[model samples]
Target: MISVDGLGPTDYERADAARLTRLPQHDLLVMAGARFGDLAPWRHPEYLRAVAGLPEEQALAALFVLGRQVPEGSLPAPLLALLSHAKIVSVGSGLLSADYALVRLEGLTLLAAWRAAGREVGSYAPWVGTDTSTLCRLVAARRTARTALDLGCGTGALAMTAARNGARALAVDINPECLAATTFNAALNGLADRVAVRQADMAALDLGERFDLVISNPPFLPLRRGALGWLAGEGGPDGLDFVWAIVRQLPELLTERGEALVQFASFGDQRGPFCAAQLADELPGLGLSARMLLKPPTPPRWPAFAERDEQGNLAGDLGREYRAYVQSIGATHYHPCVLSLRPGDGGLTIGRYS
Candidate 1:
């Protein structure tokens, strides 16, 4: 649970909601794109210049949203104190820096560890990315459900979002830090009673129960291990490690009328995401029908562990090594997709985002 400057979440929800509202919706999205859109181009000069042009409140909010440091006095004292009490920020030497980032999506306030803040967070810091956003939107669309399961859970945003829709949600994750964050966020949003957390590997999960709804944004990166060798980002030798695991369990995990949504990136050939073919081959055997939403394709990228030179260029023959690896996998394009599944005869429809 989160405390706001000596007050509990209930008090904050009743009295301090306005002061904590970070930024306008449009401004927030732009800031997020600036902060996290390009992983390789880690620094964004144009984004900084753009933030320099917003109104004072928005500009200050941008500093925290982008995980940049500013003078302690620059932000309102009450807001700073509230965030500080929640362990969302740290103040030292009269400067304020973010430990967590606050995001308001679909009328829900969510907290996640700030990746750009350069803080020494746990290996499984809550993932808040495009995939999270996509799943949250899908959760919000479901007005109600008897029960919901969030396989990855991350910040617990998906579970909380489902709880808000009148569903009892069980949030599962292998990372204790992630479970802690989810539990705290559930209380912060006044949904603690409706949400429960458990630590478990989704790859081999069985709880002797089924849910009316299920959702996940599991790790799909093809790297065997990331720079930190974190399991949260690794998808084994093939990117389908977790994807296949989830597919294997869906038949038993979902109720008769249940629905599931999973967002992940997959290697693609000229035809499209490999899921299209995998679904035809495997999902039919499971008696599940699917609708897939795909985004435009991009070239394969080197893993996060690829070494970089002083100028951020690929070090040594790392580029050649990455090319050979991509060739060995026969993956020319990277596809990001959300797959929706339900119990039915094996029918698959694929649509691309414009």
Candidate 2:
């Protein structure tokens, strides 16, 4: 289903796998990263050589290169076709890398491309043993719902899992590219019909329906600006902008007995108890009752920034400013917490801060 002509492995005419065996690990990764840029041809041979001896990392890096070069929503078909024949083993987290023998097939999985470098690698999906996953499981265990909603479903990991466990689901995201990836994965797992993918901002969903359950791994990172990867990492100035909005809107979106499971990050630099507590305090005013299902301390770090400016100065100070802010927070770390909420009385009540 993927066009193999212009973008296939054969297109790297100058890259010889034999030469890749001689390049150092660092050089290979750098070259591979460069190959994703407009300078791809200039770096092709070097990338090929760097990736030669190292199949796993090479595959990872190549996929990363491809991700940067390819248009969003266009990656899945090619990747799926590539992974069709191989047996993929989980490398850890949601990462999957293939042996040289299985390279052709495994290279196509989005997980492989993501690990290659298209996306910053992290425990973004809560299903992979994150604080979010713990909360989702807890809610599912108690509620026993037949249908659920995964808000801001990045790769549809949570949505697919819910479907596998007998919950028909709707996975929503604002990024059409992400929805395409989710659709690819859903088809791969033969759950396409059960897990519907929709491209829509969570704040203004118009599904014309409500659910017995709703879950989200919303963008809670407090970034000053947005980037290409999952916005789930940028939660706005207080880092609670999206989370707070979601909490307030959830009660109305759920059935009287419906429940909501959400995950968010709280910065140590924040003024009072983290935003989770703030949400709890305000929940009552929104006619909601909520409790902390899981809260794990996540270290706070400097926000990621681009090196260039509007004037295109190579020597920008924005990166330094970001680092300085992180240091000033006295925050060597940050914490991510998961909360479960339900409809409650008219008056608000704040729970004990963690």
Candidate 3:
């Protein structure tokens, strides 16, 4: 377990670190999942059309990645120092071209950065997947909490964000790499003192602890092998194996007045569409209530969203593997759903976002 006590940067460091946060990093963050070239595995282009036209400092800051470089003597001395400060707190090694291999969330100056999620130990990068941006937003919408727990907190985005919202957060994951990433991100965002990193499997968690809020974005992909390996994204054949385990334990993990925002997925088998409604049915029996926040239905169509990337392009092998994976599990379709759960019973509301 990594300590949260007095874990933030020194007072002097914080003043310098604040300067680096003002750099142009959000454009890169928005384009994270997009691939720029036509080649297989797609290269993450450091220079975008939008970035190429900007001023020197602003352009370099926008498209910076593993090997991109900024012109020397361009930024102020204080800002350059802050850049080094950001890198010192970053973990793993895909090599960051940006001094910090991090990205800012919309409306938040604080960043969530990770090296490419790989098979290396202490190197679990949580690819901020398709629906996670929406999930993070939903998590942020919840009222403040004194203490929060982010179960399976890969790269600790939820926990880091929770800390930003003034909560003491515990980011727990089974992988050491993930815990390390969480620790790095917590420190990177100047919230080390407010976020603790721990290693714990969701099924085996028994810390004798409970939180006022909880958030999770578990691996719900059905593939057991290939891209969905043991390192980061791994859920059994149906993908719900991990989700079911977490959902069963949620009521016990939250406080009486607590609420939780969880991201979920349901795959359609020949048997039936195992959707949010099915999960909501299970929650009531545990003295909990669930409301579906975003579930795409008619018109917009959920399948299109699942098979495409941020740029509305098919993700080559990833898309193919996902479609085949679900078919292997007897599921022809899979759905994305986010739910807000709370202690005690309440009405179940299901919704769809366009």
Candidate 4:
């Protein structure tokens, strides 16, 4: 048996050296008469059912996408060599076991360094979640920038996407594993020269340079203290800790005519939106202007805000503690939206998104 560790920059490099990225990538997994996006495929019965047949392609998906054990012959020779050299997958009994998950996004294959479900959020490379994908699409639709910054860059999806669109990118995260994962991804996607990784807390960040575009899908979930399974979701009482930190840095982080795109949830009470209205008062004072592309408000999901056990089981009633904390803070609802900021006279605008 070939023992391997979880993914890191070196693992990605080994894959690249083996020319793994040269292979055709699959973005969708078809199973049980249904097609599914690449969100934790191992948990879905549809994916497990598809993997049972062991078709060459789906078997390949089983190795990388589902992080399941696959037959030795499932992938090409080069991939086999890559897997062995990188020690990212274990080989035993003619089967290979991968501990990471890779998914396609914006024409690039992004890999998430695997950690068990109950691990600390920062201990592994984050998979591209809905907010990350939404922000990536928004950035891709916008004009390309000469330079870009992705704060709290989770697997460097946004930065890699920006590089794919013709920009040199700086991918920042507080987690070393995240930085390593981003580094590996940049090289895997052949964007290493265009993408750089940095480890720094966003609250104390000081790159001393501005970018034409800055993007983030920051942690914005509101939760009670000590109720978080992941450090990324440490949004404090109102879930605006990171949001406020990023907003406070915006005036200094963008060049003239440069824009910062942030995806976050804006809390609201009887008065109005929390961050939205607060920005109206603060952005102008900081010589910045803002526009919020608002989506319909949604109640916070109960499971997301509660703590979980090592086995990934919820520790308490479905968000019972979380909901009480939210009510205590006077926030009745939250709007998921992307806030656009630019250097200009103080002004705040709101627009609806479908």
Q: Candidate 3 on 1-354: residue-level lDDT in tens?
A: 222233346532643545445556444554454543211111344534434445644523442332344454455555444444434232235322442244555433333333331112222354444455676776676657888999888767788777778888998887765676577556556777898877888866787888998888887655453353455465655566667777788767988888887786677543334665567678778888877755542221223213467767447776676556555656555566676888877757666654
Angstrom error at residue 168, model 2: 1.9
For residue 43, model 3's alpha carbon misses the true position, in angstroms, by 8.8
Q: For residue 119, give model 3's deviation from the true position in Å.
A: 16
For all candidates, the clash counts are: 0, 15, 4, 1
lDDT of residue 35 for candidate 4: 40
Q: In model 4, what lDDT does residue 236 have?
A: 71
Q: What are the models' TM-scores?
A: 0.78, 0.58, 0.69, 0.80
TM-score of decoy 2: 0.58
Candidate models: Cα lDDT each? 0.71, 0.52, 0.59, 0.70
* Full ranking by TM-score: 4, 1, 3, 2
Best prediction by lDDT: 1
Residue-wise C-alpha lDDT for candidate 2, range 1-354, written one tens digit per residue: 111223223322222222222324433232333345521322456545655656644544443343222222322334433443222212334344332111111111122123223244433331121333344455446436678888887656667667766888999987654565566555545566788877788877787778878888777545553642554556665467677777877866787888887776666643323555566567767788776643445556444333555654323454555555566656555665666788886333333324
RMSD of each: 4.6, 11.7, 6.8, 5.0
Q: Could you tell which candidate, 1 or 2, scores higher by lDDT? A: 1
Alpha-carbon runs more than 4 Å astray in model 4? 1-25, 29-59, 71-81, 84-87, 91-95, 113-124, 224-226, 269-272, 303-305, 308-321
lDDT of 4 by residue, 3-48 (tens): 2235455555544443444334334421211344334456666546
The clash number for model 4 is 1
